[model samples]
Target: MQAPINIALVGNPNSGKSSLFNALTGLNQKVSNFPGVTVDKKTGIAHISPSLKANVIDLPGTYSLYPKSADEYVTYEVLINPANADKPDIILIIADASNLKRNLLFCSQIIDLKVPVIIALTMMDLARKKGVEIDLAGLERELGVPVVAINPRRNKGMAELKKNIELVVKEKHAPARDFIDSNVLAPDAIREIKTYFPSRSDYAALHVAVNSEELPFLNDGQKQGIKQALQEHHFNKTKVQAEEIMQRYARIKHIMKASVVETDPLQKQLRSEKIDDLLLHRFWGYAILLVVMFLLFQSIFWLASYPMDWIEGGFGALSGWLSQVLPDNKISDLFINGIIAGLGGIAVFVPQIMILFGLITVLEDTGYMSRISFLTDRLMRQVGLNGKSVMPLISGVACAVPAIMATRTIENRKERLITIMVTPLMSCSARLPIYTVMIALVIPDNRVLGILSLQGLVMMGLYLLGFFMAIFIAAIMKMLVKMKEKSYFIMELPVYRAPRWKNVGTTMVEKAKIFITDAGKVIMVISVILWFLASYGPSSKMDPVHEKYEKLIVEHPDQSEELNKAFQSEKLANSYAGILGHAIEPAIRPLGFDWKIGIALITSFAAREVFVGTMATLYSVGETPEDNDATLRQKMSAATWPDGRPVYDLATGLSLMLFYAFAMQCMSTLAIVKRETKSWKLPAVQFVYMTALAYICSFIAYILFK
Candidate 1:
């Protein structure tokens, strides 16, 4: 039996590290927490050859070894702590070739750590297109380690990369000399720290001296000793770091001079710049942004409809076929009505979600997404946020939990807090099903200009409404919070290129799988519980309904089928779900929702998308109405009040949609908010304020439209 070698993949953000990981691990990766931290740890098996295999751990992307945020801290902790389980046997450093100078600074730092390292130069294609040429062999000789040029996106150089990795792991090839003169710069401090970390490399000991307080592996005694050494030596951490960078870059320039060449010394402007000029124009930029966003929503509707309908019809047919194949019993009912119906509700929306994520990924791959952040900065700054805040806000359209996490990148505490507080106001994908169903019922599909869909226009309008509301709320918060801090926005715009179809496809698939595995579990459990509640009632209420149906069936055998269906509906109205919904019906009636809708509102506090599954269970699964052929949309459209007025009329549908748009209905999002904010106070306040706003807006909507 052979033990698997451990490989650590580390690189800067947007350095093609993840692409390489995906290429190596494919679908074998497992994502979980790293030991005790909430930061994600993604590891998978990479088979180097027939007999050699490696375990690859993708560390969080970091700019340097110094710890700044939780992410960077994790990367540093794993690398420096010898006792840590993830300390790799070998290191693969991904360096962006297009920006070789900045990339090599970190590469040089790692080389001094004396670990077996193989450099993988990514983005070489883009570098070549920009007239940048690198001598791979010269780079290897200069760095004193094996360097392989690879493009993970195109599957280029994989065999060579694998061959190099195998050789490095077997041969134990590491740099023989330090890239920087650490002994001359931090001589006294490094000697002192080495007394404690006796086995550590000189550079590792120096890092311990620089940031002993934040490193978890340091005991109190070691920390006190390191701090004392720093004080006694009069160590200047910043000045030392600056000098180290200069020394590394000085060496890098010598290396680049011999190994690199640029055909165009006068930098040629890329097509990306030309596009940005028009797309970032002061007035037209915003107008163009509005159009792009509108088109995104419109495309979701136009492109996803075919697949959505196919999924819907497939599920409907499956439900019918399963009913015929299995005997009519509680198990059958659970499978068809409870699990299938609830799952179907979620499955139909998968197309829309995938489409949205795919388009967003394409926009990101082509470099347009950064331009959006650049364009929105001015407007965002006016409202107490800067341009960087726009990324999280825009990302909220997918999910608020990660969107809030993204705020960690904003260094300004005030701006970050404001962004976190107002980000949930963006219409996330969880609310998409509710909006889609309601819009289909209330808004006609007729196109306004023969090219624009009215339903899509409504969807776009709802999204814009949320954005405007977020801005307004942030401005108000800025006035009330009394926060004063220096803020700046620094961003790099990547050169425009054709969309990387493989990357886009990978993201689309991953997102779809996440939704099914993550959100589907929540929906399934809630559905089963709701099915029980809606399936039974007190014996006094349920027994009589069954008895009356039996008596009516014998006397009027010809009408027995239709009569029995009606009896079941009557029984369900007396069921526990009905009782609870009716209890709250009076209070919600003012906002235009009835008892059934009230039940959905209660269950949906767990997640916004659960409203669709809840409705499916209560309407279709719980009552197997005579019109079993109809879809959820059809059933809701067919629903009528006691007086024969449609239940899903324009006013009622709009009211419910608006409620979901504004309300803090997702418990998972609230929990994430508490985790990120480190307090229950903000999430508590957020829930109260959002619910109040939802109610008030829904009340007004019902009054005006009904």
Candidate 2:
């Protein structure tokens, strides 16, 4: 047995590093956090040969050795600390061939770390589209390292890339050329640094001298020594860094001139720029974005309805058939009402989740997602959020845990905190079922202006409502939270390209699978616990109902079925779940929620999606066998108060929808918020504020409409 070689895939942001990683690793990848850090670290296995396998770690995107954010610092940390677990034996730097100059800066910095290096040149097709050409051999000669042109998205030049990796790892081929004369740059500091860390390369020693205070690997005495050395040499950190960059660029300029032929990629606003001209126009871009938002919410219903119906019908039939065949006992009841109902609740929404993720993925693949940030920069600033916050907030429409995690890219502490606090206010996919069911029950299915769906219009309105609420809250936070640090938005807009269908399909399937499996596990457990609570109570307390039902069954033998259903309903109302729901009933009564809704609300803190499962199980357990075939929507619709007024009329439905929209119902999101902010205070404040808002809004809606 042989240990796989450790290979680090490093590159600047938007340099196609992800494309290369996907090509190399395929589906054999895992995501975990770094030790003692919450930032995500992705690692995968890449087979290079019969005997050679590589554990390729996709390092964080960084432009230079000087890190600015937590993500970039992770990259720099791993590169400098040899003892780190993700330390690489070989480094493959993916560079955008079309934007070689900017990409080369990072490459030059990495090469000086004295590791075996290979340049995986991507975007060659884009380069050629702009009438540019690259001399691969000439580049290899100029850089003193292997340079392989690869189109990872198309799997082009992968074989050569693998060959280069094997060659570099086997030969330990360090770069033979140095772009900067380090001795000339800082002779005294370099000499002093190497004396303390004798094994460090000249460039590595120079870095230690420059960043000793910031580097975790350096000991206090070594840091003090480096500081002393710097002071004795009269070294200026900024001045030295500037000179180093200038010298490296001077060398890079010559290399690029010799080996690369440039054409004016912006000569006539290529197709991508042309599209951006309209999509990024000061006036039309905003309008187009709003239209896109409207269509996305509408399609979540229109496209997902077919599959949702099929899944619901299939599950309902299965539940009914199982009830018919299996004897009606506690075990059977638990299986049908608890596990099956819970899983089915989540499964029914799988289509909607798929559609939502697919749409988001499409926008990302088309490069329009970045344009959204560009368009929203000024608007976001007015609300005290960075433009980068817009992506996470919009992505919140899919989920908040990831969106909260996405706040890591916001370098400004105050802005990042504000984003994490307000992101959950944006309606997520978990809220879809609530919104969809409520809208169908309340909002009409008729068309407006003959081209728009009235029900869908409501759905879009809910999403917009959340977004506007986020901005409004952000504005308030902007006024409240004091900040000393400045924030800026720097993004590289990827050129437009046709969506890679294979990758898109893979993402959709993978995301959908994750959603169903993850939610299914949590929901099933919660449903089972809920079922037990709803099915059984203190025998002392429930004995009377049982005796009453027994008497009714004997007294009216011809009506045994109706009596039995009544008995079960009475038993549930006396059960533990019922008692708990009743305890909170008064608090929610003004907002139009009954005891059953209270139970759902309490159980849903584990996850917002659990509300569906809770409702399904609660209502299913209370239903007569004759109505077993009815869908959840049908059952909910047929529900009524004791006075015969419908329980789920327009007012109650809209109130519930608005409650879920604004509530901080997901525990996962809260935990992530706590982790990102590193304080329980923020999550506490967030939960309190959101819950209060949801209640107030729901109360207002119920008052106005009822």
Candidate 3:
């Protein structure tokens, strides 16, 4: 048996490193958290040969070894610490072919670490299309490393790449160059800094001593040594280091010019910029974005309605059939009302969620999202956020849980916190069901402009309302929280390309599976518990009424069996759940919610989509003799309060929509926030603040409408 070799994949941002990893590993990968950190640790196994396999790790993308934030710290720590279980046997450095100068800086730093390194020239297809030509053998000789030009997207040159990895792993090949000492500072100063921080990687430590403003969690001796080094160098350390980076680039450019060729400059077009001019223009860009967003929301509601209705009706019929087939028993009731109804409720929205995420994935993959971020940067900065927040904010429309998690990429603490805080305000897919049901109930479905539905227009208004509120809240928080560090945004705008359907399909399937499986368990349990609560009553007080109703139904010679049974069930629910609903009626009356809506609200706290399921179960319990739409809707529409007032008027439906829009009704989101922030305090604060806001907003809306 051959021993497995360890390969580390390292690269700059947007260098196609991840795409290569996905290609090499191809479903053999697993994403796990690092031992003590929340940062994702992605690992996979690749078969190098029949007798040999290799372990591959995809390190986080960073420009340099010097770390500024937690995510970058993971890259630095993993490379520097050999004792880490997954330490690399060989480093595969991926460099963007189009930006060789910037990419080579990281390559130079990696080679200096004395690790066996291989350079994978990514984006070679783009480079070729741009009329850039390279003498691969001569370039390898100049860099003193084996280099392979790979177009990972096209699956070109992968066979050669894998063969090279095997040769290096089996010790059939040797590195083209050995480590050379290149001290960026005076020798004595470097020694002193090293003495104080013995375990720190030398090059990274030197970079930090020169560039970082303040080093947190450093000892007094280390700090003093760094300060002394800076003073003795008699130069601004950062400026000197920047000059060194520039010098390295100059050397790389000289080498490339000797060994590379440009066949035609015209072929190297600025297509990305041309597209951005229109897609991200100051005026047209934002207008296009708004129009696209409006269309997305409209499609989500309109396209999903047919499927959603089918799911609802099918589940209702299935439950009715099960109730009729099974013997009248508690177990049958649990299966029919608890498990089936609960699971169906959550599953009904899967189509809408999938469609929304699929569209987002397409937008992101095409590199259009970055342009939006670039265009929105100035506005976001004014609100104390970097343009990077734009992605999370937009993604919040699919779900806030992942959007909040995505904030981990933002380096600024204040900006990231504000992004996390305001993300939930963007209407997520979970809120869509509540919004759709309520809007359908209250808003007319007339068309405007001969194309747009009035319902769609209102939905668009609510989404925009959420977005503007996010900006306003972020601006206010910017004033409230102060930090001295000046921050700027820099991002890669990859050339536009058609979406990869394979990648999009994989992402959509994975995300949908996670949502259904993870949230499904909780929904099922809550449904069963709620079913029992609404079905069974206080035995001592309700048993007599139930028995009397049962006896009265038996004695009715003219009544059909189904009608009698429905009457008995309705009487039983009224005995317990109904009483509870009335108990809370006065408290909710000001918000225009009656007992049934209050019951749905209470049940939906576990998950927002439970509103539909709760209604199904409640109505199922109160089934009538005819059991037709006219009967059910009429009963629901005419449901009366103790004072004989109707339950679901336009004002009440509007209030419900507003309430769901603002409420922190998702347990999963709260859990994820706690996990991401690593504290109960943030999630707790969010729950309290959002719930209070929901109450106040709903209350005001209801009052004004009344």
Candidate 4:
């Protein structure tokens, strides 16, 4: 059996750290939560050689060893704690070749641990294209570590990287570097502390004496001992730590100057910067962003309709067949109405979700997302949020679960909290079905300026409404939650490169799979429950009516078969489900909702998309038509209230759409929030507030229109 060598991959954000991990591990990676924290832990297995298999751990991205947030703390803890199961036998410090100075800050800290460290110089191609020539041999000599250039996206230099890893493991070569020493304690105290510091520990005990306050798990005694040592040594730990970081950058710069060559001065001036000059311009940048968002909304609405129709049609056919084959019983009705209807509801929106995520992934892979952050920074600061909040806010449009998780990168406690609080307000793709159906029913299908559709304009308005609300809510929270830390925005903007299709596809597939599996189970269960409720009724009341209708059909032998079928439909619906619908009819009457619509709304609490599925099931249960459209749309159009008013009029549909837009209808989202916030209070508050707001908005819309 081969012994597994543990290798740690570390890098700055956007240094292709994730891409490199994906390339190394491929399908071998597993994503988990870092123990007791929401931060993601990614681990995988990579074969360095035929004889050498490695367990690779990809640490959270950090600029330096000095930690700021919980996510950043994970990076520091893993590096500092040798007892961690995932601790690396060899550390591969990855650096972007183009931004060597900034990337090397963390690299130098890793090297100081005296670990068997190697430099994986990523993005070397991008650096060379801009007239920058890195002398690999000279860089290796200066850093006293083997350096291998790799383009993880293209699988370039991977062979050389693997060869170096094999050699390092065989030779057990450790990089030599200057380590920090804090002589703050008395000689006797220093000797006592040294006993606890093992040779295998990466950093010296003195380094801990200086940096321990910045760590996450230090107790009172450990903190006091470190403080006393610093006091005795007459050292200001904060200043010393800052100096160490700055010195490392300076050293990296000096080494780069000696080992690297610049070829084309103008090559650095890429189209991205030129585009950013206008796109990130304080004035036009925001305007352009808004216009781009408008286009995205329009695209989503127009592109998703065909696939949605197909999904609706497919499920309608399945349910129709199931209703015919299953014995006329509650279980049959539950399968047709509940499970099929509910799953169909969410499945219909998959296309829209995929398209939206595809666009987002493209923007991120091509490095445009960083520019979005840069453009929004000043404006975001005014709202008491950091620019990093913009990414989460944008992601919220797809779903708030990932959006909330994405806030780990923001660093500021108050800002991250504010971001999470306001994120769900952004119109997620789950709400798209509701919006699209309503908008199509209410808004005119005319074209404005011979380009923009009127329906598209209304959709754009809803998206803008959500965005502005998030900003306003965040600003209000900023004033309410007072904190001492000054908000700062510092980010690395990667050079523009062609979007990597492989990366984008992988991300889209992974996200889609998670969304389907996570939410699918809940929706299916709710659908079945709803089906049962809607199918069965009080047998004493329903059986007599059902028997009478069957007797009438048998007596009217000359009557058309279609007429008998319609009579049977009326009698069956009048059963338990119909009576239940009538029972709740009074409550929803004010909102222009019939008992059937009420059932749909109640079922949709499992997920917003279930509304359509519920409607489809309810409509299909009544009678089968020639085709889905003729059956669904026509039946829906002909639906009437008790007073002979239309159930699904333009006004009621629009009101329903607005309701779903603002409602916290997703149980999965709430569960995720509970996990991420580590408290039921936050999600509880969110659910109550959003649900109340949605109810009020929907009620007003319905009343005013009626």
Candidate 5:
């Protein structure tokens, strides 16, 4: 069997690169991290011919060879660093046909790297609609590479693309000549560098001279040698880069004139532009955005309620059945009270998670997500960030680990840091379970004006609160973190298209699966551990309760059921977990969190959603067999302190939700922050400040609501 051909799919942002990868690989893909970095690396297997398969790597989208952010650096490393393990055997550059001139500059640079290249021109339909025409044969002849027009979304041109891939591999097709002579920019430096790296082309060696310090693959000796050579030849790096870009554009202009034609250079606005006029209007845009957000939060509750009820009921029945059938042994208790209860807690939220991810996917597919950035740019600038930070902050609502990684697109260091520090304040999907459970507990389900759900309005308010607080924190950080580099926001708004229902469905399923597999594992393990702690204690403490309960049951045989309930409560208060929870109770008492809630707060640091599972487990451990039919929410609602005050009252629920919104609870997020900033200092400071903020906010919320 032949080893798979390594093919890297390179393209600019919004150039249909992701669509092409999905089309080619279908379900044969998996996402992992790039080697030694937190950036996502997507790779998959695509069959080019019956006898051959290609390992397709979807590298991060980048504009040019010059790298600024971490994401661009990953792409630059894979393409330019020969020692990179994932280096491609062939480069398939996906270029947007409608924006050919700008895309061509990147294409030309890749061509000069001497890799076998094939140009996949996407958005040709859009190009044609915009009065642009391209002669494919002429383009192929001019660029000295195979150029194939493809529409990956509709599966058009897949056969031709596959055929071209096969042919390119067979012939080892590379560009016939340099796109712009690199040696002309720095003749002496290029010549000297090539002698040291004889196998490299002049263009590749020139890059080494220019970016030696940034390139990770280069050894210290090579870097020093390259610097010495550049100095000896008096090679001006910035000037050479400028000259290279200018020269490439000069040639690209000639190519465009020869092979491409625009029917009207100044055509009327596109349909997208016409729509943007109304949708992007200053007054209407924000109103529309608010309405959109309101509907999104409302839908999460309204749509998922049926399935959530069904799931909750199913778990309740299952727990009841297990308690009755299982032999009342320790193992049975573990299954019923520990694993099953924990699984039930997290599993019930799957419907809501799917709804949230699915809606986010729709916004992205329709390109309205970019409009959001544009709409919020002014507000973002006021917070020391630009529109670039909005996407990451918005993404934080789904998950913070990837959201923090998305901050790589922000080039300004101080702005990026501020974005990272504040992003966790956004209530993420993990917190969705917390918010949903809490709101349903304390907030009324009644509709205001007989039309809008009060619960939904409160949900929206919580989300908005997080957003506003993020900006407020960003503003403060702006005043604190000192940096002089000017920040600017530049982005291209993609044309709106109908949401790809298939992609949206796929994302919904994938996110749900991730929630189950990744978070479920943690919840189940913690649930079992907590059950053990809550069920047993030091024999010295436990034996007294057992003796007291047994003696009382014998004395009052007629009221034995009531006595048993009292005994169960006494046992729980004396259990190992109870002692642990008690130790932290004083610190949290002002925030309305009892010892049980303290245990959850401590355990949920692993992940925010674990708070639900921890409560389920703790409550299950204390419940009598008759209470097994009750849901977790029911169990929590009935819970009370020794003084008889309900534990999950309005004040407690609100305080708990506030704490989660502000606190840095997820260890994974902290780890990613450390990796991204490449230091422990930032993450430590972030954890401290966020925790402090959470404590303060939670204390205030408890006081006001209590």
Candidate 6:
């Protein structure tokens, strides 16, 4: 079989490129990192024809070929770097019709790359609504490239798009004309670089001359040669870039004037603008944001309760049945107490995780996610960041790894660093399992205003706490980290649209799968280890517990069940896990953590969600055979300290929640942090400061609640 032809999808942010990619690829897509970069590379297989299956690569959305951030650099390298492995055979530029003038800047740049290019025009309805209309033939004639109008959302014009793609690939279509004269910008520099890169167009050579130092494909010798060539020509890259943009826009203005018509020169305000007037109102915007957040957090509990209960009960019955039928041996103990118990703990929270990601997806699909950045810009600026920082912080709620990677978009170095440092402070979904279980254990299930759930209110409060604390830390870091650069918040608010339910559903399912597959592996391994440690101990200590329990059962035959319970508890306390937990108990006791919780604390350094699984496994191992049917929550609620006080009361529960909130407890998070900052020192300092803060805050929470 022949290799699939590579087609790169390129467009500006929110230009409907992703939707088009999804429409073309359907369920064939996969996400991975761009070869050496952390930026997500989304690719898929699209059958353009029965004979032609294309490899569709959705490159990072960039406004111009001039790269600014890491993501933009990836797109630039893939296009301009001669040696890049995934370089496209053709470029599919998705242009937003409603904003054709602004979108043309990027389209024109891509066309000038002298590659096979197709313009998939989208949002024609949105354009017509804005009183702008374009003649498709004229647009194609002006740009000298094939232009296909498409509505990926409604699945319109896709057949024509596929047909055009197949035609272009088979024939090796290339743009007939350059949109702008590249020689006028830096003639000598382009001529000099083109000699070394004989096949490269003048435009491509100009870009290479301008960005030679940063382009990864160029060897040191080539870079030095390019540098010498540029100096010999007396090339001013910045001046040339400014001039080139001016010339392109001037030409674009003429093309728009000729091919486009507006029914009203002074058009009425768009429907989106009218709605934004209300939704983005100074006071109302913030108020609506809070209400939206409150509802989102509340819905996590309200919508997920039924499914969560079903899962919990299902696991309980499974454990009971396994206990009853499985032969009484260590193998059965490992299966029931180790594996099933741990898996059950996490599986029960899948509903909440799915709901959280689904709702977040809804926010993004409707375009309101950007409005949030707009609203938070003023506040973020006060904390030494900008609106761009809000995106990463908000994404942190989903997972810190990608969220931290998202920080690469921030152009300011100091702001980016501070954002990366404090992003983990946001309560990610991994903490959801911990939060939900803790809130259920401690907070009342009653309503606060005769309708709003008090437990949900507490859940919202915990999320708010993390966000606020992150802001506070960013403020402090701003004063300390010294890098002098003027910062600006420049962003275009995308018009709101109805939430794409398909995309939302896909996201929810994708994120849930990631959660289960990634976190489940760790939980299963830890659970088996914990079960062994909790089930067996030094034979000398184990023998004593067995002898004492056997004697007590004989002496008091009526209380044989109680004697067995005591026997299990005694054996567990002297077990390997218990010994490790006891070593840390004295240190954590002031924060209301018992030896078992201390065990969880150590194990869960692997992941915050692992705390729940660790607790489930420990408690399951300590359960008497008669208690096999009890839920993890029930087992935990019935737990007691030596003095018989409930182990997971309001104080301890809140304290544990607060600790997880501030602690750098996730090894994955730390690893990503190191990757992002590219420094072990930053992550080390992050771990130290966060752990200390967790300890101090947990102590205070325990004191106040107790």
- lDDT scores of the candidates, listed in order: 0.86, 0.88, 0.76, 0.76, 0.92, 0.91
Using Cα atoms with residue i matched to residue i, what is each candidate's TM-score against the true structure? 0.93, 0.97, 0.89, 0.90, 0.98, 0.98
**Residue 184, candidate 6: C-alpha displacement in angstroms:** 3.0
Of the two candidates 5 and 6, the one with more favorable lDDT, higher being better, is 5
Worst 10 residues of 5 by lDDT: 193-202
| Tens-digit lDDT track of model 6 for 155-197 | 9999999899888877886898889989888878888887766
Question: lDDT of candidate 1 vs native?
Answer: 0.86
What lDDT tens digits, residue by residue, belong to model 5 across residues 62-162? 88988888889999989887878998999999999999999999999999999999999999988988899999999999999999999999999999999
The stretch of ten residues in a row with the least summed lDDT in candidate 4 is 179-188
Q: Which is superior by lDDT, 1 or 4?
A: 1
After superposing candidate 3 on the true structure, give the runs of residues whose Cα lies further than 4 Å from its correct spot.
1-3, 172-175, 178-180, 184-186, 189-240, 263-268, 554-583, 603-605, 622-646, 671-681
State which candidate, 4 or 6, has the greater lDDT. 6
Clashing pairs in 4: 131-263, 184-233, 338-527, 338-528, 537-576
Candidate 2 positional error at 420, Å: 1.1
lDDT, residue 130, candidate 5: 88
* Segments of candidate 4 deviating more than 4 angstroms: 177-192, 196-204, 211-235, 263-268, 315-343, 547-587, 624-635
The per-residue C-alpha lDDT of model 1 at residue 290 equals 84
Which candidate leads in lDDT?
5
lDDT of 4 by residue, 291-317 (tens): 877877788777877887888678767
Query: Cα lDDT for residue 228, model 2?
Result: 87
Count of clashing residue pairs in every prediction: 0, 0, 0, 5, 0, 0
Question: Which 10-residue window in model 1 sums to the lowest lDDT?
Answer: 621-630
What is the C-alpha local distance difference test score of candidate 5? 0.92
Instruction: Indicate the worst ten consecutive residues by lDDT in candidate 6.
Output: 194-203
Candidate 3, position 405, lDDT: 72
lDDT of residue 152 for candidate 6: 92
